[model samples]
Target chain A: MTGGRLAVRKTYKLFIGGAFPRSESGRTLELEGYNVARASRKDAREAVVAARKAFGGWSAATAYNRGQVLYRLAETMETRAGAFAAACTGRREVARAIDRVVWYAGWADKLAQVLGSANPVAGPYFNFTIPEPTGVVAIIAPTEPALDGLVARLAPAVVGGNAVIILASDDHPLAAIELAEAVATSDVPGGVVNVLTGLRSELAPVLAAHMDVNAIDVTGADGDVAALEVLAAENVKRVVRAREDRSPWEIASFMELKTVWHPIGR
Target chain B: MTDLQKRGDRSPVPTDWTYAPAPESTDIVRLQERYGLYVGGEWLETKDQFTTIAPRDESPLAEVGQASEADVQNAVAAAREAFKSWSKLPATERAKYLFRIARILAERSREFAVLESLNGGKPIKESRDVDLPLAAAHFFYYAGWADKLEYAYPNRSPKPLGVAGQIIPWNFPLLMLAWKIAPALACGNTVVLKPAETTPLTALLFADVCRQAEVPPGVVNIVTGDGSTGAHLVRSEGIGKVAFTGSTEVGKAIQRELAGRDISLTLELGGKAANIVFEDCALDQAVEGIVNGIYFNQGHVCCAGSRLLVQESIHDQLVRKLKRRMSTLRVGDPLDKNTDVGAINSKAQLDRITELVQAGTDEGAELYQPPCRLPEKGWWFAPTVFTNVAQSHRIAQEEIFGPVLSVLTFRTPDEAVEKANNTMYGLSAGIWTEKGSRILWMADRLRAGVVWGNTFNRFDPASPFGGYKESGFGREGGRHGLEAYLRFE
Candidate 1:
């Protein structure tokens, strides 16, 4: 309009079950001259159902296969780095986010070695501790460093075979939906990465209480950390509050250790 | 109808004469009329007392101090107070203490072995050969890790959590005690241990060993009581961690009780392990393993192979051999050296086994209990196996925690795995096969925590053991076991 040309505009929607869908509640919030999907509790629940349904296949996917899909997502995100930069106010944030996914991609296969090992359990038994994904994880992305923070929460979880349902930043959610657009094209399986753009205050509590959900990463809920933690106890979902460090342990935090002791002898 | 008269398979009676009774003399196991709680490295007065009866004859072996909530609080406080100095001690010094405990356990082996059999109703042979030896081995293994935590999880700075509240089961009292206390002490955490009411004697005896080893006062305390005392300790404030080995029912209540708390928990709960016998397995060895799997510990093992999933091809042959082998199993005095099966742990447990066995018959499954005579004085269950058992049978699904086995058949590897993982409890499994590839393939698919190939009911200190899903979480033993007692930065 500034240059006397017709500018194309996009409508932001929630990512559920591999497709961009309008909120089931048909609610939208007017922010920065854009119609952002004001995701409803029902929408969050649907995403979770879709996520729980997808957990088995995604978690059962080979580590190499998961790493490849994540790498493809990074490639897709890199192509739209400029759009993400504009949404988050910096290109560096988008780059860090891309690098973070790549970093996590390298960790998919190596994590078991770093986190699990065979035990010489002083008998004629062959024992091993294998780290398996801790089912569906509900992630609340922190508001500020929007793009980087979102990637930071998403990568570590799925890298260890866990499926995630991430609630995008309320104001700066355009980048996440754009990332979701790439997720649609990327080999990341449907429902593996479900993103909803909504008020963290409105969505997080319901997700926290969802019994089917295995863990709640509440780094985003700065205001409702205590409430989320208490709500998580309903099903004893593993709760991770604002984490300062980002390592394989973060991946491990969402992984359950399964030790097998088999007797070995004639 | 009588068990023998009602069976589908007419198991050939063992015409051979039974072995002469080889009872281990209880003379060495001297008992006191009353034993108090071992709190702060010394025996203390208790408000109440309960008699711990031997299951072999329902005879009161000793009266143990019944620890109340107040007693549990005192133990936790003692453990918490000891943590400050204990955690500050040099690693080498801590290792020395563990070494001392291990040495003392070895010296008092016979005393512990005899008392273990008398108190827990396990066969004397098992107490001496399996229980006491493994208990001492647990101490020895954890003792080596005292100075080596840094190397164990390289690059990670390992630090001990404060006081650990440990609750052990009746099945392997002192051994479970060693599994809990050794790891906690080695990690620099003090402990408040509650031994099961049925088998509190060996733990009390272990306390004497701890005192003799000169372990710091309040570093290790043994409080004996029933479920309520354990509930108090589980809910008690200021406990850094809780490690429990018991039934799945109690484990869940504890999980719900500790929900949202920062305290760490490691639960070794119930299991309905599937012992899959393949067509290619060494038939004779597999039969011996199968009998040992269920008959050992009177089938009181959490990791006991309660379900026998024999391959359809070898189903008849295996069942005939199993029935014959089970018949030869001498179920009599727990103190008897020749006994293959012992007492059924407690009256309540015996009733449970009886009720389930009745259900198996009521459900139209063929019940084939051996013709061996059980002692009239004690809670006894003959070595029993139920054939033609469906997947829906309660005996097939539930943890009988007794010498009851449900036989099911599978046509393929996938079917075997599907049936094996059908239970809510995934503590352990047994796979008998000659094919190495099949063993690995089946091991990968089975959901159980521990998988035994060609053998069953084997445990070691270095092995990390716990269940998947409701078999409970967190591991006990090995380097992974250390995670339960430590807080990593």
Candidate 2:
């Protein structure tokens, strides 16, 4: 060793269908002192296809199973808190992110009771309404407090059984890819959570316009939310902005209420 | 092949069992010669006007004002001005106005029912039994919620969203108005409502009901016109939210126009629902449900079960029974109490249905129209059932919005779910099965907003009603309906 101990740098890549793969475009952008994969529009489209393919089983899974998977996500992150603190944000943010995941995990089984209702409808029918996932939701992760903000959006969405394809913060993309790594090991079935990193301008519009995408969380969208919402309207997508407060309503934003009616007969 | 064999060899409906005309009297409704825009609790005259006609015989009922851009501006200003006091009123005070409106509606139910039939072309049986009562019930329902706003959305303070711009379809004019106005007013939001061009009379009459209930001036405004008027109202400034119940095309346009803006929107759009009848279903009860599912309101309902997906094994028996039952339906005057199906809403809608039915025939599906004599005076379409319909058939995919049913068969429940949900619309679906477990299982799989088991085309104010996917979003009934009008703090 001529001067110092050898240091091996980590390779940052795109996560699709639970696998870390180089951007299909084989593109990379130099950020700070590292090279990060720059996802292409085609990459965003593929992520949507992956998410849609996984939606059935992921959404159909019992809420308790989803809750356990999400809680395991917290456990996985807790073990990697030091790495996330070094790679993304401070230790406090990492701990909060893990705690936030555990918080949403508890909501997985209780969302129906809180959001659903057994109506006293004026009829000879038993009528009730329950919340169901809005299917494949695309999120734009916030730049600051990257891990905390990303988990804030991702946990609520997946807790409601939605398969997600998130666009990580361009400047803070490492934490998201790292979170995807955690997701892969957290028993969140493959493709249920796909992470794409690239120029927000390049990837946000593609995800916004994807027909298979049912709802979009524009919380971290850079000044282009108006444009993104316009594109989202092409498929009548549910457009939601960042909620100022953390609550179950945030989860409800990504869900569709389904009402069922049955004849009350002897 | 003989006509009988072509029709699946159904026995003829006995002519001797004809219903003698038991017509409801039209004298109860007193329509004004000319109606003006109801803005700020007063009738304001406008130069532009259109005649709303009784679709039963093409008779002119009243002259309705065509709200111009300037008129819409006045309505919005009125609603905005009203919102100041209306939103600030004691919640209990607000509740009383709605209770009064509901009471007034029930008191004058007959008049509204006759006018709804005369102006909207739905049967008196429906307007009296279903539409009028439901309309009043919506008011009664939301009235109770006015003071309970704190409990509706947990951990959030609910506040009114100022003025709401609501555009309702002609199919269920008065009821749609109630659906739009009640919760809105209950949530403390003033509304600027535009009734469909063909059916503006009932809404104008509702304006009088508001006055009778002593609702605050400018709290409720009625702007009557066609699509242009609705467009103007939608684009008008001072509207905090837009609630539209119409075709998906218009709903999409509204969405695009509101894009990049801060206004909230909810659309209740079109649907081509599947009414699946399983082999294990009670055949006769399923037959009645099938008929009611498609023929209700002349199939003008957005959630109409226009596509019948029958289990392959029971297809023949169900079709035969459905055909025989359809033959007994009396398609006649909307004012006739015995009329099972009323006149089509308008000539334009009738043409749309005719064109789609022709497409079904051209695409190699067998069409069955019961031998009922359609009246010559106004637009009418015979209750139609198309069998041997392919999943790809236009009639199976499109919302005919008339008395039409397209029948297709499925061998398995998985195939039934696949075929039922293949469409772009997911407003509602019907499952006919005596098996309880299968009903719940199928209900979980059908990608629809509303699922009706062993029954169809049912509605209640306490029950949430809306769609999934392209049929549009935001529920219009029940506690869930409150979300659209209130902004959480």
Candidate 3:
């Protein structure tokens, strides 16, 4: 038993409302003789519909419930480690991706504490500021270290109870689709995570400027930073600039300040 | 003449004269009817049309489809139809489309920049360095928002406001398109975009880019024409929201047009931005801001620092330095790599700028110009700065959309804020301060959409940008930017 090696199977499909399916577009992109899945603009829109459907219930969930779901998602991702690792070119990268999930999973319960604090206003009222999750986040996954970078960028957002529309790296998007499958099996709600794999240049602007999306993560772009910043300003979507040297502790990038005021008399 | 000689000695001129390449132009008739108006994933043609001319030399650039009343009706109808289903889509999936669009825009950035310069009469360096990159970045930045609205404005549920009618100015044509269109799309609202009349070619090219990205038709409908088409789109009953970037007069007109109507409006209108220099500020940095403020885009910007408010203590010193700087400002063909100032956007804009410069001289203000030759055929203006300008002067009150700076002096910080806020427009303002607390204090009091501390005219997608008061309402960057496109659920 100690000498034997375990074999794992990999499945790549579009994730919509926590369900895995062949793209509604029924499209597949080819990379290195492997069939990578893709979703059409319509499929992408459908994913958005699915996330919108799940938004109320998922967003309405208690913090405890959201944390539990995120924790369970991390656990499920751990079990699919072999598949994800195989999808990547190296084991070190896959390990980092799995570690990223766990790191962010822990953040589900702790983000409010780390990114938020009680605000001492000039007035005499109970005011405490906490961090909240933006609803649906559109992400451009890193182009180079596909799986690890994608996971690192996405986990903080989803763990915070935000749904995600991620245009996975076109060159090596299979890992992202496979991760979507893992998320489906996990306790994450339906439409909580949607992954689109195709030409990123073709897909990013649609996501960047989609009115329904709340924030954009441009950490995956390999080109001009200024132009991307300007485009993101169109609807004033919160943008997270891509940083190659940042670490997992950079989870604060997905956090937003939320001030809550209540009457002390109550 | 003695004052000019005195001012020349204090500030030295910049010696750099390198310029960038110009864009090639094609016949307008060939481009007009051939392109389809993108609406709801369908390419449709309009019965009405208009021709666009290059402002550089009065040459035809492109003939664009003028959205017929019927075409506008159909596009809005499609947007309304899509809104039912599209708005209902999960925020995450909506985000995917935006991400996809961002990616596509990045791939075709070079082509967009070249086309933008060719159509808009902007320099190739500006189109490449400032406009195209920012245009693509706008998409990338907003793409991430598809699924993140909840966190943007906490407590309240953010929703899509359906179709957005977006009209962009010609100053930074493609960049403005990104500014108006990206967040609208990200928020799940379909759009009918109108590029300026003088610069419709790049926008038409963007339509091609949208098609390549497979952006569903009716999702982005581009109808290119002048103010009439824009007025039609703004007043159209089908549009739920309107976003415009243009002159203050036009913005007020648009505001009146939407009054009493159930429409959300975001106006990024004209600005007479003040670039204030204090005695304590860094001279080199302030000089750079001065040049960048008024010289970038050949001062065709609404937010260009047309008013240079220098501290009375530093007035003589700064003016002397500025005149020396002005002497080296290369004024020539926009296509020449050696030219610092490019061609003016249009004859109308040129006439307006020249008229204002003339008015400054007519008033008590003394005019100063560095030795520079103006292009004969095309619309052009040398970088001119007026001194001894009073706050009450027309040159100080009105926006001169050209490479001209009006110099004035303020005795105190209160005066700086008072003079800065005196204008009807409040798009942007710049303060040169060494003290951190003073920067914060001034930023709090400034009514402008954007306040630049230490630096001027800097922009980021993460940082919210927009104006207050008559300059405009609503924001165009960061999380505040999304509010214009989203509805509260």
Q: Indicate which candidate wins on lDDT.
A: 2
Q: Would you give the TM-score of chain B in model 1?
A: 0.96
For candidate 3 chain B, which ten residues in a row score worst on lDDT?
A: B21-30
Kindly list the per-residue Cα lDDT of model 3 for residues B1-489, writing each as its tens digit: 122223455874335433344434333223553555677667777776666766667777555677777777777888888788777777787777777777877777666766666667677677767777677778888888878878775656777888899998888888888888889888888888888888877777777777777666677888776688888898788889999998767876676565345578777777898887889988877888899899888998887888999999988888888889888877765544455678898888889988999999999889888988776677888888899899899999998888888998898998888888787666777878676567655654555656666666655555556654456656676665787897654
| TM-score sort, best first | 2, 1, 3
Worst 10 residues of 2 chain B by lDDT: B1-10
> Candidate 3's error at A251, in angstroms?
30
lDDT of 2 by residue, B313-398 (tens): 98998899999999999999999998989999999999999999999999999999989899989889999999999988899888
Residue B393, candidate 3: alpha-carbon lDDT? 96
- What would the per-residue lDDT of candidate 1 be over residues A144-180, giving only the tens digit for each residue? 7888888888889988887789998887788788888
What residue runs in model 3 are displaced by over 4 Å at the alpha carbon?
A1-266, B1-36
TM-score of chain B taken alone, candidate 3: 0.91
> Candidate 1: misplaced stretches above 4 Å?
A1-9, A23-57, A86-90, A121-126, A140-145, A167-176, A196-244, A260-266, B1-16
Top model by DockQ, which number?
Answer: 2
lDDT by residue (A11-98, candidate 2, tens digit) is: 9999998889899999998875679999999999999989999999999999999999999999999888887987676899998899
* Total colliding residue pairs, candidate 2: 0
Can you list each candidate's DockQ?
0.44, 0.80, 0.01
